[model samples]
Target: MTLKRLILSVIALAVIVFGLIVTGIWGPSGHNPAPEQQVQTTQTPPGMSRGEYVAKMSDCTACHTTEKDKPFAGGLGMPLPIGTLYSTNITPDKETGIGNYSLDDFKRVLREGVRKDGGHLYPAMPYTEYTKLSDNDIAAMYDYFMNSVQPVKQANRPNDIPALLSMRWPLAIWNWMFHEQGAYQTQQDKGAEWNRGAYLVQGSTHCGTCHTPRGVAMQTTANDETETGFLSGADLAGWHAFNISNDNANGLGDWSNDEIVQYLKTGSVAGKAQAAGPMAEAVENSFRFLTDDDLNAIAVYLRSVPAVSEGSTSRYAQGEAVAQDLQLRGLPIETTREEMPGEYLYMANCSTCHDADGSGSPDGYYPSVYHNSVVGSEKSGNLIQVVLHGVKRDTNDGEVFMPAFGQHLSDDQIATLVNFLTDTYGQGNAQVEPQDVAELRATAE
Candidate 1:
């Protein structure tokens, strides 16, 4: 063999390999094709009609629409560590919403966190998790939004993030580093129900968007089952998204499958947890409408997860019955008001519905303060907010209402009541202060 021939062959091979790598001719396995190349404009999958069910499952309206706004006419402000960011209109309005976005554009936004104009979208949209959505599901959602949803003319509100942080270009870098772009793959060993649950929770539904804890950069710590924080819970806005993990103490350990199903379906489960704040909105707009089978699947998947404990007693263990007779009479004498204001306030305002012993109404409509997830949570935000704003849920049985005390009670009074409720019926002292109540009240206003 001639040395010249061997050298020429090696040079040719190196040039071919370099070209392949530069042009991405030999890409890694499982790489999603470019949005333009992957467009699917055909009709939705069989049996999927308007994609309304998928929208309901995803809880689209929860963050997109305000109480006074039309559905999908996004203006809801989501408060983050950096600033308040308003959701964009997703209705089919071309001027203000996504009416002009093609299926490819929509898929790009969901899968790559990039917009029609190639602008990067903030992670606040939960596209990190939505990246796992199947093409069929994304098509259905696109069809529903474009064809079924009503278009609104409302313009998007500008985000309140500071000048430096408001820049969208950095998000592209962030997505490149942290986001996983592809369709969800099923686990070979898990059952169909488990996989379905995983698809719903991890993909379209994106439950971990709120439940999972975030890192210092305000990015979610984990999005899948591989991370311990998956569904383990975190603080959102001012409300504590209590752990949904199977941990006996901190999570849903004591909850039966039926109880979890009931809670998701009805937004409340007798003496156990009742959805409130953001959770209540999710249930009202989304979970309540989910099929029974999906709800059961969620329960099953949650049960299978390993528990993440926070070293607290289970909800079942914390609620000790208080003596009825110990309930305070009329407001305490002025001399002792400073010392036992909570007792006096509870007796006057709360006990009428909650009962003197903190045991709620017999039908569990009022919900016992004891064994109540809000009261027992390590954070007292939900309890304080509920007191200030009240709670209302309409179910098959009837509408349940807790009157708002913010108008009547001073910040001190609400703080006092929260402390009393937590101390009596909960595990740890709420440690809520009047200033905290004042802050929450101001935000609500």
Candidate 2:
């Protein structure tokens, strides 16, 4: 044989080997589930309502529903580094949705990130954490999707990613590197309540997907409470998911277990905190509907999460009322409004609802900015986001509405107002500039 022929053969072999290593073409995938789980999938759960409850526990509506009229006909645009990925239609429509997916197929999709057609779904579905759901829960969820949900006929949209990047094969490599597929294993040392809470937070809720920091690959840096980074708080996409762990100042360390329960149940805890953004949505759709036992369990588990202090400042301890009202009162006799724009903005726009002292109204319907987690946090992103976007959270009680000033106020004006809030009622650490407001405003847009 010629030397050139042998050299070409070796080159081809090297390329093939490289491809195999990178893509893990030979590796096992979403088809695998434990023997017991497989058997449990076949059996009927005690009640159909449990299925709906499980669906809510998974917070399926948050990602899968965009329009109010069309729930679970998923078309939410999830932003990726290279491109945008649109969620698939999960409604039970035969033509465009998962109408034909069998129980086993649903199980594979939920736990393994494999679609019914044997294609890989991006980790945006949170299958890595969904893998921890019990077999009964998976079965119940399947039942809910199949029988309870009203099927919508919307066609699935193609992702905006590039052709080569869109190939499913590369995901095999990603899965091998990042995915941890399995069901929850109960801790013998912990009580039933703690275990239940752990299962809910780590499994269905997938709290780490937001609260935990991510690696370069966008996989959560930590999967469970055993890791210090798990739920340690992450600031991303212009919003900060504050630490839900037991760290003081930054986290819930100073919060009583009952306070945690109240926060989850109502989306507000008077002077302490109030939910806004995605968290407000979570409260409106999922957490507020949780059963008392489950709420208590979650509180118990969060209380037990080891303290992970990020800084010396106790966020809740910072700031006092700076008498902005007095400044506003003397405004006519003193310098022009241009001199104190921050104070002026607060008094004119905010004081009616939030009060001159930044203290909430009598009924606690409007929450205080002072001694509040959102305003006092080190990052100040949430406060900025709230000011730009406004707050609208609804529960069985009623709706809490704060109108958006994004259109009315300029970037500099928004920054001025937020800096005033932080200085007068919060830590005064957030010396927000107009650029900060502009950047975060762009993301929201």
Candidate 3:
């Protein structure tokens, strides 16, 4: 053959090879559980309120709804690394929602992470962890969504992304590398409650979706509580969800089992912490309804897990010992003069309840801002929302609620208090713009 013809042939071959590599056709196919293998749907026998309870425990509404106007209709704008993902309508609206999803279809999506049409769901759905749920649990979730949830008429908007990046097929490869299949394994050595807790947190609840660290590929670097990194917390949409592991400095090692249950139940425990952002929703809709045994199970499971460090990234660390000592050395005033502006505003408005130092007294009362992670986070979205929209933590043991504060705190004051708290403790660098606070304030109304 002529040199020119041979050169053209080589170019064509190179193009084909490059395409294969980019598309990951050369790699082992990712594990996508077969349709039947993934989810098993059976008729709900009588007296099985397990489905309804499971739905509440999963807290599906957090993503599936925007405001309370349309429940499970799914138009919430979920921010992503690439852009924004609009939640799909899960209501049984045949025209616009998942009304047509059969029991098996729902199960497949939940257990296998595939949509009704075989498209892989974005890991944003957390099916990688959900896939650990048993066939019975998937069926329970399906029954709850299909039979119980009120059908809202809402059309899901297409995901806001260019077609190139919106490609769902590539996720098949992602799943293969990171996703695992099968039901949660019962830990024989551990108690039944602990194993049950493991299944709920690691599987249906998919707590790791927010709490676990992500790899460069953006998948959960570690999937199980067995790994120290698992449930250690992750940053989502600029907000850092604090570590849930047993790390003394950053994780929950210091928090007692009762405190964990209390926080999950009531949103805040007296001197400890309060729920904020997506976690508030999880508490309000899900954990508050958990059975005492289940809450205890979760606490026990969390306590039993190993502490894995995802990396050297430190948000909570050894504070300057001398600085904390100096702050403590001073007879703590009710609130300092400069800090009093924010304090006075809070008193006139929030003090009848939250008290002066942002400490909610009377044991398990309003949230304490001192040393609280939500106040300390670099991202002010959750903190801003709490100030602007007030949050009730959760109702696991019983309901403990915080009223909305948006009407009371002006944008400047909110910004001032945020600055004061961050400066005093927390990651001191956090700053909120009046403009951003105003924007969020608009949403509160």
Per-residue lDDT of model 2, residues 1-445, tens digit only: 3446534644564566568777877444344455453212222224537788778878889889999899999999988865789998899999999999999899888888889999998998989888888888888788889998899999988899867567776565567657877787777688878888888888877778888988766789888788767898887678988887788766888888888888888888976888899899888988887787787788888877777788877766666656677766745724636888888888778888888888778898987778788877777888888888899999879988999888889989988888878777777767888999899988983
Candidate 3 has an lDDT of 0.68
Best by lDDT: 2
Best by TM-score: 2
- RMSD after CA superposition, every candidate: 10.0, 6.2, 8.0
TM-score of each: 0.85, 0.89, 0.74
- List candidate 1 stretches off by more than 4 Å: 1-30, 33-50, 67-69, 162-164, 324-339
Model 1 scores worst on lDDT over the 10 consecutive residues at: 36-45
- lDDT string for model 1 (1-445, tens) is 2446534644564566557768877443335744443222222234557377777778878778775448889988877656788999999999999998999999889888888988898888888888877787788889999998889899999988877557676565456446778877767688878877777788877889989998755678877777777888887777778788888878887789899889888888876788777787788777877777778778878877678888866654566668543644453467346667767777678888888888878988778888787887777888899999898776656666889899999998888889888888887667888999988887773
lDDT against the true structure, each candidate: 0.77, 0.80, 0.68
How high a TM-score does candidate 2 get? 0.89
343: Cα error in model 1, Å = 2.3
Score candidate 2 by lDDT: 0.80
* Runs with alpha carbons beyond 4 Å of true place in candidate 3: 1-48, 67-69, 308-352, 357-359, 371-385, 393-416, 422-445
Error of 1 at 293 (Å): 0.3
